[model samples]
Target: MKKFIYFIFGGVTFILGTIGIFLPILPTVPFYLASGFFWVRSSDQAYQFLLSNKWYQQYVTEWLVKRKMTVRQRIQILLILFVLLAIPFIAVPNTWMRLVLGCVFIGHCIFFIFFFDKKRTRQKISSENKIFFR
Candidate 1:
């Protein structure tokens, strides 16, 4: 029963994450992460499929392993965030809401600029070090 529930949730979140690829306002990573979480708990096959997927490899696994994004990736994410938020920032009539949107934009900018792209030293994997797929 628990595994069944997890599988169902994983499927739902995976669909959302896939949809998010085409919809800028809907975030891709979070949904993918959620799907991965459920899949890992429920079905190893599903989790492995996600791990081997090109999109997941490019977007989620790279970030998870490296803890940083390339400049181009960072720029793309920022631009999407800007475009998604800019419309509301401009069209919203409520002053407080506009202020909130502006703040959110600024916050996203700061995070992607300073924090998301931080450089880290890569440790050399020696022959003795085994890389686990899971």
Candidate 2:
């Protein structure tokens, strides 16, 4: 059943997100977002819980309502990518392997940071709004 799947996803996301909080490479926010959505579709309690979470409330709150990302979030994501993806290549022993992995990682980050993140789009909108409103 769909509901069962959501419950399972919610549990997994919560666990992974919780782990992400402690481990820098794991990324807690995305898992939280995933779990929260699962909860949203599956149970009112889960939706309410995610919405109420003090750590996650800000990102999901305005974004869910207005579909925006804050400037701080944008910067944070770039920083995370730099730390997690870029740094790892230095340790890779094989030159070709390093190059390939680095390129893939760069591509992934570029796509996610540029195309996927709503905050960047929101920033553009807000900037345009400022120009028009001013």
Candidate 3:
């Protein structure tokens, strides 16, 4: 039952992420990452499928293996997230609401800056669980 729920949740999130690729307001990578998380917990087959997929790999599996995004990818994702988060901050008429949004924005900024380390070198992803440098 838990596995079934996870599979369903993962499918839904992955669909949302795919739709997000076409819609500016929707976030793409995050949803797929969430889907990958649920799928990984639900089934090894699903996890392996996602890991083998070239396009989907970037969303989560690559991060799992590498432990961090490449510097360029991190900068791009952060800048986009900041801009999207700023929309509410700029458009909201209420001062207190804007302040709250400001805090949320700051929190995300801090998270991306500190939570993820920079990828210094390109590592060869191995067939095994371990990662190695070329």
Task: Name the candidate, 1 or 3, with the larger lDDT value.
Answer: 1
Count residue pairs with overlapping backbones in model 1.
Answer: 0
- Candidate 3's error at 106, in angstroms? 1.7
Candidate lDDT (C-alpha), each: 0.80, 0.75, 0.74
> Tens digit of lDDT per residue, candidate 2, span 11-122?
8998888787677788776888899889988989877887788767654555454555666766676677766655666776778877887787678667655664666777
Identify the superior model by lDDT, candidate 1 or candidate 2. Answer: 1
Clashes of 2: 0
RMSD of each: 5.0, 5.5, 5.8
Model 2: CA > 4 A from native: 58-91, 104-123, 126-134
Q: Per-prediction TM-score, please?
A: 0.78, 0.56, 0.62
* Model 3 residue 6 lDDT score: 97
Between candidates 1 and 2, name the one with more favorable TM-score: 1
